[model samples]
Target: MSEVWAERQRRTNQLVRGIARKVLEGPIDGNRLYGLCRLTWITEAYDAEHPAYIRSTKIPALGDALHQNFTGRTLDEVANEVATQLERPELETLVRSHTGFTNFYKAYRNSAREWMLMHEAEITAIFQRAYLLQSDADAQLLGADIAALPSIPKANHPHLLMRPEYLLTPACFALDPRLRFPILNGAERVQSVLRRIGAADRSVPAQIQLFVGLIGQNGVRDAADLDQLGLTALDGLGRADHEPMRQLLMHVPDEGDSLPLKDEEDVRRLQQALDVAQRRVHNSMTNKLRQLLANWTLLEGRAKDCRYDVLVKGYDGGDNDLLLEVKSSVDSAQIRMAIGQVYDYWHRLMGPSSDCHAAIVLPGRPDTATEELLQWLEVGLLWLEGGQLYTSTEWLEEFVAAVGPKK
Candidate 1:
């Protein structure tokens, strides 16, 4: 069993190195390639551990390192720093003996060197072609060719070879679909072929190990009993938060499978964290707006099953009220959702009255298309720029006029 596991590890490393080499040979910049490799290693190593271990021990240490050294630094620079730190005898000993991997550092270096040597000719040829074409389409075609390679192991799944969860590849790919690589496409589609193989011949334990690494023990009972999990808010959060939920969900064996209840709960916890972060930003914007509208009455809009972050009523004692939906950043989806939500709240509280104007308030302005959409919907747009709140629509102007000019 150990021998089989060792061989599985070797084959997986081979595939990863092959894909990495292909990318290296392509027109991709150094920063991106370094980022890809760094994330791949982190995910491969970290996912292999128990979730409890990660949450309790790994996260604190990792978080500190990230907060201290990784903040505002490029991944390539961070990778170098991490490599330098790990080379210290004391740190290396502490990591190897305590973490899930047994002699992980040594094994990783040895396997990487071995794979590079073994795939030198293939890697060279791929690089040559990549340089000759220098087009993303050509790189993608090369990936397809690599996926079709007859010498590659057919039974082993690509998900195991490249754990997408750790590298943020799935989320990055989703945000900019152009980031698609042949290796990723292969990994995503391998399960279909794997289904045809005999259950006995299939590497169920390997699959289980990869699953355990990606999702943690709480998400699954055993390797054989696995379900699909979706990381919602991937698209919404992808722009602001580079590390996305899709990265966390990429390790699921099948894309179609449903997540267990535990995984769903974990996702809920993540959503709550995001809400808190956004609220912090919203609060800052609210405070600034409140100061500006000192004479006008500012009240929180509350309704059954819904709540508005802020509502501004004019000092003129008229029915004219401004319903503001505050967001940290107004992406297209957020604006769309906010528009519907504002209408729902207004109709429930005020009941179909033109006396109230709905506006989407954001920390930053949205794109021209999103701005146009807001105008068409008759939803006013307000944003903060250079430490001042600015408005684009006539409704906002009326609301500001009621409060009078800045002191």
Candidate 2:
């Protein structure tokens, strides 16, 4: 994960763990359960499964089913309506039979409140035990105990309800921030990431534990950072708007640290190399632009901790600012990285000031796909070809008229 993202996660963790200490770990009550529903990753997974009902109603259904509050009465009415709906002939095929409908009604009729009352003590005990987890054995047992939880409720699929991995994992992490327990959507995506990184084969729980350990070794101190690693690995490469997957892809390990830097010296050396390379890339691009374009003021731009390669100020002696990011190569990976980086630098660093533009400077002309991607992002492109500077069609007219004809 980039330092920017890691820092964001750190701030988020502080808030999350603070809430856990105050709301989740303090006492068992409606507010505590409501906090889990509203403040944790469990909310997303749960809402996806129960989109038919809003939290104001569903949470009370889960926690205070027999109460006389409006929420409870509304939920009770909903359960009755659902039972009546299940009696329809069309739903019989989907729901199995009258007996199945009866069971489904009973699951709700019995109320999530009743179920919670029966198992709340055990669930809380397991959640508290997360603070004491010390080894793989402890994690395995925790995973097992969580799996033993009665069900992961589904408003739409009564028969399909099973273990609440999504809820339990986040609950455990919230209670025991030290464990950095990953918020699991499911096992398939985690398994896919492990395979893509060439991690050894293992059970889903073991694989997650392995990833947790790997990220910790690599200086990832937040659960959100681990999630970012998986997201970048899984979706970033294929999606242009995402952070470049190459950042994570370049460091995958077959048998060691996910991001392997043997020691402090190795990290220092890598940073030094990157700094030198960036300087050369920026300097060369800046020098070439100086020779190619006339009557334009060029300088480096800085915003907070981020730096732009070259900032072209007062274009054509006007107030327009054009920010350029120079890439040393035109490969798809380089272009993709350039796109994400420049877009971030442009929107975030440059802000939404009027008459400001952003573009990528490349060593050679990119292919059709790269051009299309940049065009879709509404980013201008400039490349070197046969000792001449070339701009994308969208920029060519402006360059010819305002910035002087391309050399």
lDDT score for residue 202 of model 2: 52
* Tens digit of per-residue lDDT, candidate 2, span 176-287: 5464666554545444666655553554476556656644332244555565455323323323354421222112122322332212232243343244454454455555
- Candidate lDDT values, in order: 0.41, 0.49
Candidate 1 versus truth, CA RMSD in Å, comes to 20.7
Superposed on all Cα atoms, the candidates' RMSDs to the truth, in angstroms, are 20.7, 17.7
Positional deviation of residue 75's Cα in model 2 after best superposition, in angstroms:
25
Q: How far does residue 262 in candidate 1 sit from its true spot (Å)?
A: 25
Q: Residue 149 CA error for candidate 2 (Å)?
A: 2.7
